[model samples]
Target: MSTIQRPSRPCKECQRRKLRCDAQQPKCGLCQRARVPCEASPAGKRGPKRGHLDALRNRLVQLEETLQNRLDSEQHPQEHAQALHYSPGSTDASQSTDFLRGDVGYGDPLPQAFMLPGPSMAGDADTLGLGPFPFPDLAVSLPQIDRGTHAELDQLYFDRVHPSFPILHKRRYLNWSKSTAKSRSQTCLQQVMWILATLLSTQSRDLINPLYSRVKQDIDLIIMDTGPCQLELVQAWTLLTVCELMRALYGQAWASAGRMFRLLQGLRYHEIDSPRKDPVASEGMIDPIRTEEKRRVFWMAFLIDHLLSIRNRWPICTRLPISDHAFQAAQLGSSTFLSQAVTEPPSSDTCSFNECIIIATLSGRGLLRDVHGTISEAYGGSGQIHIDHDEWLNLVLATRNQALRQRNDSDRMGTFAQILGQVTEILFCKSLMTMNKNSSTESCTQEYRCRVLRAAEKIVLFAADLTALHFSMVHPFMFIPLFVTAEFLYENRALGDGAFLTQLRSLVDVFGQLTNVNDHERSYLDLLSRSCQQNIAIMPATTCVELKRIARDFLEALEDPNDPTKAQAVASADLSVTHESYPSTEGLEQFLSGWAKAKQFMPNFRMELVDMVAEVDASGSGGKVWVFSKVTGGGGGTDRDSIDMMSINGEGKVWKTKDVQRITSKH
Candidate 1:
């Protein structure tokens, strides 16, 4: 069947070789002779052939155009607004574009998606750019450190500080540190690291003070400089806050933490991803390593804010928008990535340490959340509300269980976890104390006292144990637990036993040994020492009368001797096991006159002598008197001692008098 006569073309091979071709149907004659199958090129294809370099160049051109368009829109917003208003809204193909454009108005100037290096880029600083991060215009400049000093400081930081807080990525940081052309972000971070290392490693104020000043100046310069917040800068501020905390500069630390919180929110680190309608799908395509590091930084910021809030006794500034489940999922994903990335298996110590930190961080979040709730309930909103003790206790127990479940062989982390658990317990107990401070029922009052004493005991025991093991490893910032315990013991002198006293002395010694203890900490130590001695002195007084007498005598001794009324003899008599002679009515009258004179001179020295049996009769000649028992010891009426009182009418008034026989006579 003769098909329509077909137009013929040369085979592709013949055309490529540029040989003249005789029109053929199936194959050219040359291809047939050569025994080669031939094909013809398709018609109507007309475009420049694209190579790898050409494709890359095209992408670069496209990016440049896009950047220029963005800059132009920013520079001339009215034009952009006009364009947006004129654009068609109903086109199916334009829907995605419209949605993206909507986000452009609300999007952060420096989106978090651009914070980390891409998968192809190995280093963050290199990926960002080697130029100085633009800071606000400032006259002060950052000091530069030599490579050797930088390396030494880095090593010191990783060895001492990073072990406790592994916020920085070891491999990534090491790689960045080796770069010759460091950015301002990198310089700020290095300075903070040096400051922390020097602060922890040295007790010499002369050395650390200068280093701290230079670091602070650098931080100030960086903060004042104008640029989009970078991850490195966030990290620098985080470390700087930590350094401030180590120095017991709580106000400064809190302020720095607030700044860090703002920066983190600016970066949208508070959210797992942007809440914009047109979220970037490329975020999911980021390198797992970089994603993991970002997750770590976010959690670190979260933890720092929570811890600072707890320390400052304020509400947490940042709300955790991400759920715990999501956090756990991210943690698991990062762990999987780490496992895949490491060629050699991690040591058990390393695994345990990492697990301990992770578990502690998670549990600490829960604990801090409950603490915030308690604080809010008690002190926020309207007025003080009743703390649900059982609910708070259950929360503490749950957190403690979670922490203990993840405990490992690492002593430092394990002890720290335990200490945190005890701290939570103490906080809960303290909340109850605050709520029940003015409770009307005696049972409630007794329950509150018992709970407080128990919490105090637990705190002291946990702190003593922690101090015994790797005390030097304990951060001075952690001494809050000890401080709380000391205050409790001081207030409730009956709770301090010989063992507790000994442990308290040991804690003071540990505080002394800490290289990072600032003047605040030293002052706390001194106060704790004096409180411990005072409590120890009252330890021997078993009866309520003896306790009261000792306390009164101590207080009286502290009076200003220059005052005529306070010029009584310093009572050297041991009230623990001594009985004095009782005075006659005339002698008692003289003592009453002296007591009244003392009260007038010292407004703070009002003493109410209560009779244990019945109310003293004040009905004599238009005068009134009442007697009540005074219990100096804490807890529920365990040790009761009573002293009698008398009231005499003088100058149309009742003068309260203490019966000498009732005080000196054994009950």
Candidate 2:
């Protein structure tokens, strides 16, 4: 075939560089000269399709028509007053404009996207910024620390603390007052001091010993001076009461710490006089002590609730090693009113620590269960509705029976869902505390953890907003659902930690409930419906894929019968080949499956696969590696703790590559 000689097309600069050109402006000439991948458009190419252009034009015309109609109505004195009643639909505002210009899209809007909810509502005192607030510099006015003071105290404390369940520390910036202003420095120091103190309080709660009592007493004395202490006192009191019940159940000393915790809980939400007549004020609101307080509470609640699950013999973890049977028996046999304790009339001698324990325990357990469900569903599924049809039917039956029983006993008391919701705040607060400070670069090994946290914070806010809505609507019926969602969100926060996308979806789902309520305010209902629909529609496709992968992992884990190491190894390799370290719960499960698969062929097989790693070295160069291996697996057999793989590894041992393991013999 004879080739027709066509004129070569090259932009001026590309011709100078003697380079083949895609022949485009802006990016063509310089990029071609640099031998870079030229992103310049090919000559004579048109931009995005004309359909988009036509759509834009139609939208503009429609908006213009509406505006013109509004202006025309305004300009005529005869119709000016009537214009107020003229709805857009009556004026020729096309439905397409409403549909096309629905609301803000999925991706973050530049600048405004980053602007935060606080700045958007800057005029309001109640609002706080979504991101970490910048700590103002005030150190110049502060007194210098003495040489004796261990300046590394803060860092040391963080190190000694149990690696917070999630690896990353919530981001918090340093705010020190200047030498000239010792007062501000003192204030900031006090805040940090309280935060650290509260964290230590939860740690102490777990100690469950005589030393714990003395330590808590002394700690209480110190924290009582801080602003958030009053609430902390309630938590402390609750912990102490629970401890006392434990002791009392075993015939130990009748410690009166229960009264202190009760007094504190009762003190919360009590209204205070304010010079500003802000109608929104409820009680002297519990200003978060340190950002971590709520998180600590959630974690504590999570632990306690799991304990309750074992106690109640909840079927979910029945296969796991826990004293579920013994717990259930004890619960049934106990006559000291453990279940009904909190509601019982308090005696003069003691407020019945048993009641506080039961109530707190119930609250904690509810939060944990809900959170587990949320995280499990979020991190390990295909966006499928988690409702087990059978489970829902059972729940309906149980709730109906309980509702009837409560009606027969005391009409004033809440329904089962309401009680669940009320107790959930305890867990939710903890989740908030843990997540409120997410500014660190710590590798998230659990994908769902971050997702859960993000969803939780948003959900909590959504619930709070909905609660306000219910109160505004003057509908008592809405409270139970609100509480249920709040509790669910609270647990979600604790479990997900800071998984932003997952958490946002969770919140959207709960907000969806408000939209369904007929009594909800029309404006709020509209905003919620639109926001939720938009969020769901625009959620990134990658997230859906990740969610599905996570779900698949969970399903595989649950279904696989063989606990063999070989089988697990095969599964792990299949799941985690793409990432070195497990980026999420799903990834971890995949690794566990790999280990199980490996054991099938090599009974003694044990392996660890760490992915998405960043190790800081002395010279600051960072390197990462991934491995699939076969090795010995040995440990104290129990599900309560993770295997100490580091301790188990022999010094100088290296894993060599081998044939990929498969979960089944057929493979």
Worst 10 residues of 1 by lDDT: 570-579
lDDT digits (tens) for residues 158-221 of candidate 1: 7777755556776668888868798777877876777777665533234466566655655655
List per-candidate RMSD values in Å: 32.0, 30.6
Give the lDDT of residue 548 in candidate 1: 31
C-alpha root-mean-square deviation, candidate 2? 30.6
lDDT measured at residue 501 in model 2 versus the true structure, 0 to 100: 33
Q: lDDT tens string, model 2, 523-636?
A: 222233232313322221122222222222332343343543433432333233322222322343455555455446555433322111121223211111222222233332
Q: List per-prediction Cα lDDT, in the order shown.
A: 0.47, 0.32
Which of the numbered candidates is closest to the native, going by highest lDDT?
1
TM-score of each: 0.48, 0.19
Candidate 1: which pairs clash? 134-226, 135-225, 135-226, 136-224, 136-225, 136-226, 610-628, 618-623, 618-624, 618-625
TM-score of 1: 0.48
